[model samples]
Target: MATRAEPIRQLRLRTPTDLEAEAVRNVAGALNALLADTFALYLKTKNFHWHVSGPHFRDYHLMLDEQATQIFAMTDELAERVRKIGAPTLRSIGQIAGMQRVLDNNADYVDPDDMLAELRDDNKDFVQRMREARDLCDDSRDAATASLLETFIDQSERRVWFLYETSRRGDGTGH
Candidate 1:
């Protein structure tokens, strides 16, 4: 006898909030993209951490591990923020890949300095993205998300600063 398959039920986890539907939609959209980028950056940081070599191996490894941990910490809060606003967060790695703006670095080997420079640039871009999201939150009057983005932006800026300093040579410029 053939068994009938059950139809999937669409779950609507609509949380009640004073924010308007449009505002929720806008904030959720921005947050979701940011979350995806966060995941991408986290993975890249971990990759570099695991693969790093040369004289500064221990320092670079520890720094990337710390940065990776920090990046991973943001994922939960970002998704929760989207859900709190009555929207569905990203459900899969595929969703994250689709939405992520940060480029992946899948190479056999990379110079440690090059890795730091690349991550610095990516983090700088991420800071701008957060700023844009904060502006959107301000426009939507979603002070909660705006405040969260502010914290994340500051953290990202710190990451950029670290990467920039580490990658620098004699002149202090990363040249």
Candidate 2:
């Protein structure tokens, strides 16, 4: 019943019949984490965009807007990669919760400092997930996806450092 017409049909992509099962599963697992992390982090970025208020409000607001755009783009790229591997792309919040290794913040009111803390943690989680993805990709001899994961992990590390630095400032303890 499989056909090439379906938008999500991935068998057409032609993966090796003898592909490393464990490595593929690990890569898929890591991508699922990335999927959920990106979605949840997208929500957090939107929250901070709406709620952030401090002397650095304008700066953070602009930065968050740009970061959110990048995150959303990453989400799409990751989902497509899942489809390319003949796996189902994550489609629901429940699935996201099942796969994500990171915890969401429960603060009723997020001060700017807390917002930065939240984003830093989120980015760190994403970076770790990407690192795992790269490892799996390497084991599977998937240089293309490994290269993509390299970009994602690099961006995540940079974002984490930027947010952490913002949170740890002294004179500009603006968070």
Candidate 3:
């Protein structure tokens, strides 16, 4: 029997003009940042899903799963898009921790409200970065990337709204 060598796949990026390429890089950087944000958010949501209790246990349990699911898909999508653009995707834990603007504590348990607050802040940070990405893409004449950023911003804002609403409703209602 003959041993076969490993197969190699090389991805190529379209050679956009300088300005367009800059837009792609800017968007890619922001998206890369967004991936890190999502990873942090994913852990937060998963933590809350496991440790959240009292008052809104059922609601929050399902909510974390739903919200985290969106980020999970986005994580893969963003990384692939980065690779498609000939840029490397940084998915390592240290890389993610270093790049992410979001703050999360994976070392210890936190309260339900604290979990919600942390995730809300992270989503809001994502919205801000995504808006920046959209503006950069638009200025650089890359509507496709702009559109992608818009979609992500939309969902992130909705997530922020959801968590905010939950926090608001939890106050003084004794649920």
> Per-residue alpha-carbon lDDT of model 1 for 48-112, expressed as tens digits?
99999999999999999999999999999999999998888999999999999999999999999
Q: List the candidate numbers ranked by TM-score, top first.
A: 1, 2, 3
Please report the candidate that would top lDDT against the real structure. Answer: 1
Q: Determine the C-alpha RMSD for candidate 1 after optimal superposition of all C-alphas.
A: 4.1
lDDT of 2 by residue, 114-141 (tens): 8888788878877877887788888888
Clashing pairs in 1: none
What's the lDDT for all of these models? 0.94, 0.79, 0.77
The estimated TM-scores of all candidates read 0.91, 0.81, 0.80
Kindly give the number of clashing pairs for every candidate.
0, 0, 1
lDDT digits (tens) for residues 60-104 of candidate 3: 999999998887878887787666555667858999999977677
Winner of 2 and 3 under TM-score: 2
Higher-lDDT candidate of 1 and 3: 1
**Can you give the lDDT of residue 122 in candidate 3?**
77
Return the lDDT, model 2, position 50.
79
